[model samples]
Target chain A: MKVLALDTSNRPLSVSVLNYDKVLATTTITTQRKHAAYAMQTIEDLVKVAKLKPSDLDRVVVAQGPGSYTGLRVAVTIGKVLSDTLKIDLVGISSLLALSLNVEKEGQLVAPTFDARNDILFTGLYRITSNGPKSVLPDQHISFEEWLKQLDQFDESIVFVGEDVANFKARLQAHFGTNFKSVVGIDNLPQAARIGIYGEQQRPVSDIDTFVPDYLRLTQAESDWQKLHPGEGHESYVEQV
Target chain B: MKNENSLILSFETSCDETSVAVIKNGKEILSNIVATQIKSHQRFGGVVPEVASRHHIEQITICLNDALQKAGVTYSDLTGVAITYGPGLVGSLLVGITAAKVVAWAHQLPLIPVNHIAGHIYATNFDHPIEFPALALVVSGGHTELVWMPKEGEFKIIGETRDDAAGETYDKIGRVLGINYPAGPQVDQMAHLGHDTFAFPRAMEKNDNFDFSFSGLKSAFINTVHHADQINATLDKNDLATSFQQAVIDVLVSKAMRALDKYPAKEFILAGGVAANRGLRERLDQELEKRDVEFVKAPLKLCGDNAAMIGAAAEMLQRHGAKADMSLNANPGLEFEWAENEEE
Candidate 1:
């Protein structure tokens, strides 16, 4: 089973072509705001290096949102189009989970944090078990302080994984001290192989058209409009307006 | 599935519309699917870039599938993938560009990057072939420019708006009337029903340069309505719309005629979203007829952002051997220039 996985939900863009559990080829490019520019080209290059045609791929996996909005759209949009066009299944993996896959040790908590700007972070907690990473905390958009407060309950040492880990490293140390640990260097970046493996273990989307990026937050316009039309959560902003 | 007929799949997501098309050879559009977000943006009174990007990603795949299925063509039958790569909101443009790049690279098909304005100009070709040395007046929500195309597929910006675009000005003025978001057509409709009452200033009409300035006119219109409200005077909505539309049309027609007189061309094509304006189209037709220059008004549907136009422009690029590689990025300000320096 050939699976093509893509992860551009963060600063580092990663693409991997895998044959079931075996990795055939993987490519990564670390450049901010260059994911959309390099994403498809990297995927094409990876497929070429793997000596396979686009049609040879059986499934497509993509790291869905909770990271950069444009970056997530790049992967999800292409994944949907490719899967639909190639008549293959498409699976969406949490970007937070993909980041957690950077942690190699078992019996440790993998806490992936993506900077959401203004001191807020899109983060989640996952436990690294022998059977892949298991979700311990659902993806949430909260302030760093609030997120740290929620993590106080876990007794195990936590390994924060993600490109933005460095940004909050100092604050994280102040919060949990010795209990808080982070993977430094390349291991911190999310990889497409991780997305592929995680997706292989998950179910494919039943309807490709309905599947979209999991943007945890609303657009500024929508948020503002919602504020004006208070208590109109059930209705769409357009309809309420 | 490679055959004598080369099918080019195209995408356009420069703004609130997510469009996909399958064009056979350039002239024939097998299928053109446009999923517009106008309804979604109507509440915002204008296009929100973030909202537009979100819609494009969601609608692109569906549009692509529909375009292919409607055309009854498979990926193997495709000759290339063409996409509008710029002169649009970055977030919106990236969705289409990324989608195009992926499909092109995945299938090993050539990718053709098309300028949005070029797409609008080529949209007129769906009805008839554009004559060389054509002077095209491109007007849309984001742009208002006079492009001098000396030969087929060559573009030269003769003049452009210095301030608000003609369509943008109409929208801003239309907001006072509580009209729908895109006010070009609404103002045009009201213009046909009422007389041009108020004398709105037509900026840069007497100037020798072909450049336009609509900011002054827009402010004048806004001030007129606001002043009337202060004085408790109820102004006629239709007359206001008529006068504003006339002001815009006067400036546009004047600049276009100036460009045409300076550089005589075989054809004068009116393209872009504002080309759908009834008053502007009629005026251009009358003037071009007097000059004996063939007038081509873009089809109302083609005047807006769509993939068929991108497909048409891509055909010209393909003929000129202007295939974009995987390195092509979505340029927010992708400009077009004359390609006379390149070999055919």
Candidate 2:
């Protein structure tokens, strides 16, 4: 099966064309907010290098959010349009899971994180299982201090992955000591190939129109509205007004 | 691709409107689809950047398909792709940029980056081509500026607002009157119903320079409303709206007339969101008519925000070989730089 996958949920924008489990062509650009400018050209070039047209793709996979709001929207928009336009199966994967699955260590706990500003991180804990990295903790947006406290309760060594890990490296090392091992390199960046592999294991979205990026946190405006109207349903300010 | 046969597909998401349009030779708009998120933002009293970005992503492809279908064209027929890259919300602009980049790359076409404010000004060309030495009054929610165009594709910003844009001031004052988000049209309607009872202060009115200041006017309007509220005195909403609108129009017209005297252009353009105002449009028409200058305003439907104007701007850019490579990125505060004169 020919699969085209994209990951722009974080700083690094990755695009890959794959045949089944093996990767045919992949490009990873480690630039901030360049997703909109570079993702399509990379995807088109990758597909062309692999000698396939957009219509020949069997499935489309993309990294669903909980990271940069604009970055995630870039990839998700392309993914949805390509999949829906070509009438192909569309699959969405957690961005943090894609970063964690990049770790090759077996039985190692992977805690992939993306900086969420204000000392918070969009992160989740995963354990490398026989099949792949299984989620030990679901994706969430929490402060680094809180997430570190949760990691302290774990008994095994944790492998920190993702481009933003360096931002909290000193604190991570202080907390985990010898048990914490850092995986820092180009390979640690979120890869579309990983997204494609994991997407195969998951079910495709039944309705493409209803699918949206999984922005874990509400926008500032939405939050402000919520604070003003306590315990109100999430019907949006426009509807309520 | 050039000339009358050239087909440009444009994307515009610099604000709450997600628009896509297919234009031929820059002037003929075959299809212009604008999926507005005004309702989604009305409750928040303004556009929420995140919501605008999300909606742009969801509607971009649909708008793209509709534009192509309505134009009776296909990707193969597209000569180039165009998009508004900046001077608005970064998040909102990125969606259109990404979508346009992808479509252009997939089809192996040149990507033309357009300025959003320029697009607003260029909307005047939808039915009629702009004459050379054109003077434009660009007024929108985010901008209030006077641009001088010596020739086609040449723009120079001679004057602009230092504080709040005219449309922004309208919305802010509209909130005081308990109106919905995007108070420009609502306030204009109310202004038409009542007379200007209170003579509001026209900020920077007597200034020698063309630069404007509306923050003082906004403050005065807010303070008056609050003072009235404190005394439990009822205020006429129409009169307040009329008084505020008159103040804004007074300053805008004064600055524009000053520019006209300095530049002496043959053509005058009323562009952007506030260009739809009944008072401003009539005032410019009457004012420009005295000078024997052709007065052109963006059609009411195209005045808000749409991609058709972007398509028109792209056609102009393509003539100058202003193609954006893969390194093109969205600039939230993008400025229009005329490269043609520099090369000359």
Candidate 3:
């Protein structure tokens, strides 16, 4: 099965066409939130390098986010359209989990960090179990100090993943010293290929009829209402098809 | 191929709505599907960028299929793809751009880049074929600008809002009155019932150019309401809405007329969601007639945010040989440099 992968969930834009077990072509570009304009160009260049036509693709996959709002939206939006036009399945995968999936070390704990601004990180603790990378902690907004406290329990070497790690590298190194291993990920900050593999495993059907972005934050309006009204329960929307 | 027409699929996810449309020959709209996040944002009183983007992805496919099916055309039949490239919420723009890009690549069709403002002006082409070398006033929640298009597809902005747009002021005024968001339409409706007894100051009315400032009027409305509430004075919502809307209309109409006087253009195009204002349309039509200038306003549906306008602009762009080879980009800070001059 052929899979097309794309990610605009951060500063970097990434795309990959994977042939099930093998990668045909993968591309990553790091730019300032220019994903909407550059995303298609990157995809075209990749398609040309792979000697493939857009029609040849079997499925479309994209990184669903806990990352940049603009990046995630563009990636997922394109993913849905491509799958719909090609009459293929569509898949949405978590960007954080995808980052964890790219860790090279086989053992020990891995924590992927995403800068959530206001000095907070969209982060979670993970352990590479025999099955695969398994979550040790749920994704949540935590202060840098709080996260370091969570990581203090493990005496083993821990590998940090994600671009957010760079911003806090000094504090992290100062706290963990040599116990923490610092490494630069693949040139591209985003890993669209993981989205494809995850999509295949999840096998989400393209319901061009019904699909939406998975933004973890409440809309500004919702927040405004909540603040203005004070103590109103969050209204749940029964998404209509 | 000796084809007389080109089928263009257009997408607009620039704001609260995720819209898709199929335009044939620029003017004929086979289908226009809009999945509005209105309800989603109703409780919040405004659009949320994150939520808007999320909604765009979910509705992208449904909207695409609905348009194609309504147009009675398959993906293979499309000759080109068009998408709104700017002057909107960047995140929202990304969603539509991404979709348009993939369609362009998948179909191996030429990509057409469309300016949202250009599309709003082109919406006038929906009802009446516009005469060239005309002036267009684009007013919406996000924008308020006077543009001069000397020829087809070339846009130059002349005057614009220094603060809140005409629609933004409407929404702000509406909020103080407990009306739904986008109080522009509701206020317009209410204005018909009440007289302009309260004369809110019109900013920049005496300016030589068509520059506008709705923020002062907005603050004036808010302070008036707050003062009334503080002094325990009764206020009529409808009269207040009407009076406020009238203030905006007077200034808008006057400025539009001023533009007509300075530049003798073939047509006057009213664009953007605010163009749906009945008061503005009627006033402009009457005023433009006095000047003997042709007036073109987009159909009520096209006036608001939709992909059909994008398709319209794209059709003109394609006709002008402006083919985007996957190089089209989102320009959130998009501005018409030529618009700095009333006519160039």
Clashes of each: 0, 0, 6
Task: Order the numbered candidates by TM-score, best leading.
Answer: 1, 3, 2
TM-score of predicted chain A against the true chain A, for each candidate: 0.93, 0.94, 0.84
lDDT of 2 at B62: 72
The C-alpha RMSD of each candidate to the native structure, in angstroms, is 3.2, 3.9, 3.3
Residue pairs with colliding backbones in model 2 are none
Question: By how many angstroms RMSD does model 1 differ from the true structure?
Answer: 3.2
Q: Which stretches of candidate 2 lie over 4 Å from their true place?
A: A1-3, A27-33, A38-60, A84-89, A105-109, A117-119, A143-158, A163-187, A200-206, A230-241, B1-4, B337-344
- Which pairs in model 3 have colliding backbones? A8-A71, A211-B58, A212-B58, A221-B44, B156-B339, B157-B339
Candidate 2 lDDT over residue span B236-329, tens digit each: 9899989999999999999999988878788899999899999888777777778868888899988988999999988888988879976577
For model 3, the docking class works out as: medium
Error of 3 at B167 (Å): 1.3
lDDT of 3 at B194: 84
What tens digits encode model 3's per-residue C-alpha lDDT throughout A110-162? 78788888888878777776555777887666788788888888887777888
Kindly list the per-residue Cα lDDT of model 3 for residues B1-344, writing each as its tens digit. 21568889999988888899999888888888887777777766777676777777777777888889889898778889998888888777877888888888888888888888988888877666778898998999999988988887678877888888889888888888888886777889888888777788888999888889998898888998999999999888878987898889888888988887877798888889999999888888778777777888878877888898889889989999877767677778788875544343
Residue-wise C-alpha lDDT for candidate 1, range B208-234, written one tens digit per residue: 888899999999999999999999999
- lDDT (CA) for every model shown? 0.87, 0.85, 0.80
Q: Evaluated with DockQ, which candidate comes out highest? A: 3
